[model samples]
Each structure stands twice: as C-alpha cells, then as structure tokens.
Target: MVKEIKLLIKKRQSYIKEFWSYINWGIIVCSWAGVVIHIFRQTELKKLSNSLENVKGLKPISLTFFAYLDSLLTYLTELKKLSNSLENVKGLKPISLTFFAYLDSLLTYLLSFCCFFGTIKILRLLRINRRLSLLTLTLKKSAKQLLGFFLMFVVIFVAFNSLFYLLYHSYVRHYSSWLDTALTCFQMSSRHLSTIPDLKKIDTFIAAMSLFLFILLVVFMLTNMFVSIIVENFNIVRREPFNHENEVELIHFTIDKIRQWLSMSTRKRKIQTKTDPITEFPEKIDELMLAVDKLYGNTKR
Candidate 1:
C-alpha cells in the first residue's frame, strides 16, 4: 500500500515537472519578442543584428535597453550559427524539390508550438486582447489538423499520379510527358482542374474511362473522406478543454465508490481502509454516472 502511494506521488511529481518545463520553455520563447528569426533563409539575421546600430532614425529608446536587447540577440545568433548544418535540409539549392518533406513540416510545428503555448498564454494573462488570443489558438490548432490532411492528400496524390502516369503512358498520347500526367493528377485531386475543353485532344475510350474514375475518386470518394477526417478530429480538439471537468468528476466518483467498497468489505473495516485505492478513468460522464448508480443505488424508475 505504501509502495503504491509512493509510485503515485512520483508520477504526479513528474507531471508537475513537465508542466513547469513547458512554462520555462514559454519564457525562453517570449524572450525573443521583437527580434525575428528567419527560416528558409528568407532574410539574413546576421545583417539585421549587425546593422541595428547604424540605421538612422532618432533612436528614442535608451542605450541600456538596446544593449540588453543585443545581449538577448546574441543568444539567437548563437542558435542560428548551429543551424548552419541544415544547409542541405530542404534539398539542393539548385532544384526546389525538397529531399524529404518533413523538414518543411517541422517549421509549422515549431511556429505553432511557440505561438499557441508561449505567446498565447502570456497574452491571456495580460487580459487585454482576448479575441486575438483566441484567434491565435484556433489557428494553431487548425494548422495542425490541416497539416495532417495535407500529408494524407500527398500520399493519395502520389498513388493516383503513378496510376494515371501508367494509364496515360500506355493508352494516351495527349499527355506528352510524365510530369504533365502528375500535374494533371494533382490538379484533379486538388479540385482545381481547368475545364474539360482542355482535354479535347484525347478522344480515346481508355482516356475517357480513366478521366471518369479520376473525377469519381476526387469528387466522390477522397474529398468526402478528407472532409470527414477533418471534421471528426476538429471535434476531438474542441472537446479537450471540457475534459478537466470530466476528470475532476471522475476522481470524486472513484473516491466515493472506493470508500463504499472499503466500508462494506468483510476482511475487517480498518484492514480494507488501509489498502491502496485503485484509480479508474471513466471515458464518459454517462459511464461514471452508471457506475455510481450501480454502487450507491439509483432512484430512477
């Protein structure tokens, strides 16, 4: 019994530690408030940091403040220096094709993580701009879901690209190159296909059949599948905020049930009370309520 209590206490301490780690990470994230960190080499941070002093505008801010800002800026520059190794992360600079796409994905994730967890929490604490805070949170959550949907689309689009490439290569002459076939498949999958009049050159039966199936897959099957996944997962994300109340109720219900079970045990009242309590999670309120009824008796007719 004492061992179980020790384990629970250790587990709880670990969780608390993780929560505070998140807050400290948030602080580090907010420390870079005004300075920008460029990704994908969009702009050179070195040039900005070096020239901050020489830029001519009557510097209204105090030198002490600017010097302190430069100190924080040095930490960022050191971090950027570490990123020199990522020169080849997004494929060769010559060709735009990314070597592996997940590197690009990591950008969105870090951005959302910092903004949603760090900046959003800080803004909420300020209580000055609730609407903006909510909007930031909504966009962060939605972007995660949208990124999943996009990756799914990429997989399906690749499969269909290969299928259509084969079909066009074997039976059709209108598509002059494999790249053309891929672009066509992507266009159809994205529902951005131009009018059918563009395909007037292809008048074969196989071509027509393939086109029919392409439209059917894009419009009828894949579109609905993607939409359903997005809607379902979006609801799951929306439900997360209410889970705290459910968890609290579950804790209370479990305690009461355990108390009753211990009091009714025949092994000896004190002996039962001394035993370690088991924790149970009710996935739904109805399940918890039903368990309570079974234990305490329900008055419903």
Candidate 2:
C-alpha cells in the first residue's frame, strides 16, 4: 500500500509539471494572439473612421497608452469645425471584404497552429511513452532546418504572390484588387482553389505555375526533408538519454544577455556621470588621456 501511494504521488507531481508547461505555452500563444488582435483592432478602427462622414468627430484609437487621450484632445480642438466638415466628407475608400476575411482567417490559422504544438507538448506527460520522447528529440534537433525552410518558403510565397497580384490586377478584370491575389495564392497552396475564378491566359499560366511550385516545394521537398530529418535523428534520440542540461544552459545564457541589454544604458549613464571624461576610462588609458589633456591645455593657454 505504501509503495502504491508513493507511485501515485510521483505520478501526480509529474502531471502537475506537465500542466505547468502546457500553461506556459498557452501564455506564450496568448501573447502572439494579443499582437494579432492589436493589428486587427487598428485595421477595424481605420475602417470605422473612414466610414464616418466626419472622422474628426471619431474618438482616437491606438495601441499606445496615451493614444486615447491624444485623440480626444485632437477631436475636442476640432469640435467646432467637425460639424461643418461632415457635409463634404466623400473620399472614404471602400474596405475590401477579402482583406478583412484574410486577416481573421490568418489569425485563426496561427492560433490553431500554436494550439497544435501546445497539445503535443502536453502529450509529453506520459513518461512511459518512448515514441513521444523520440519524436520530441527529433524535432528539437531539426528545429533549425525547419526554421530555415520556413523562411525560404516565406520569401518564395511573397515573391510569387506579388508577381501574380501585379499581373492579375492589371490584366484580369475579375480580380477586384491586389489583396485578392494574395488570398488566392494562400488558398491554392492549401488545395482550396474554388474561390479563384478564371483569368487571362497569361494569368492562368502564372497561377498554374504557382500551383506547381507549391507542390514541388512545400508538398514534396520540405515534407521529404522533414521526414528524412526525423528518421535520421530518431536513431540518435533512441541511443542517447533525455538530457536537458543544454536547454538549461541556453536559458541561462539568454537571461544573461537580456540582463546585459537592460543594464547597458545604465552602465553608459554611469560612465557619463563622471565630470571629467578621463575618469571614465580604465587605468590603461590614463597615460594617453593625460598626454592629450596636457597638450590641449597647453595649446589653449
């Protein structure tokens, strides 16, 4: 009975640790979500203000602390003229529906991606699961390659999307704007090509080429590389015990760097506090400083 109780207590502690890790990941994901929310809020604020006949009457909106106060002050100062300006306020640009949807869907996709990874992290709580351990270790080793591949894909996606947007926005009458071009490219890569309509022959050829590129790069090359990486690293993971001292060292190094950065200005400020610049230097520079100061003093005299 005592042995069973001890085992239960250990398992409970392990579960709590895993829960804490999952919560930490959730907090990190929430930070990213906050950024996305702020961006969308800015966009929506602009859309709202533009829709108003008198934007000067609208309240100030910003992500900064004193933004609302600044906007309020500006609006109050222009309150007398705000009524008069409403008569001729006809220059508001129509906001694109696709762009609005794109922003929202992008956020959803990102949140889902973070949650998927967080779920995987939580799954590591099963201490008896060797497969999970191996998978995690393999991913840890291949992290750099995955990041590099992601950056490469981003550059390619942006470049081709820009090319397609430029081509379609000019020649194809169906595409409403450049935003549609980006949305279409994203959709095509995901194998959801129903929304994009038919275009000019040249535009069609570019779209087809983009589809082929997505297949060749994202679907085949990167996927195959990742598979190979996992298989190669799995052997190493199986042979080596789970060692986290490197991660602890890395965390410590990161914290030290952050501390140094935060104190850098304070250190500089301290150096500046010296009335005589010569006093700020180490003893090694004292001789050079004395020679320069004496020469300058003599020259001035």
Candidate RMSDs in order: 18.1, 24.7
Q: Which ten residues in a row have the lowest lDDT in candidate 1?
A: 92-101
Residue 10, candidate 2: C-alpha displacement in angstroms:
25
- Compare the candidates by TM-score and give the number of the best one: 2
Q: Go through the candidates in order and give the clash count of each.
A: 0, 0
lDDT values, one for every candidate: 0.51, 0.59
Instruction: Give the alpha carbon lDDT tens digit for every residue of 16-125 in model 1.
Output: 54433455555455434323332432233333334344434423222222222223356346435433433433432322213212323344445556666765455544
Kindly report which residue pairs in candidate 1 clash with one another.
Answer: none
TM-score of every candidate relative to the true structure: 0.32, 0.38
Candidate 2 lDDT, tens digit per residue, 92-121?
A: 454333454445445655666667666765
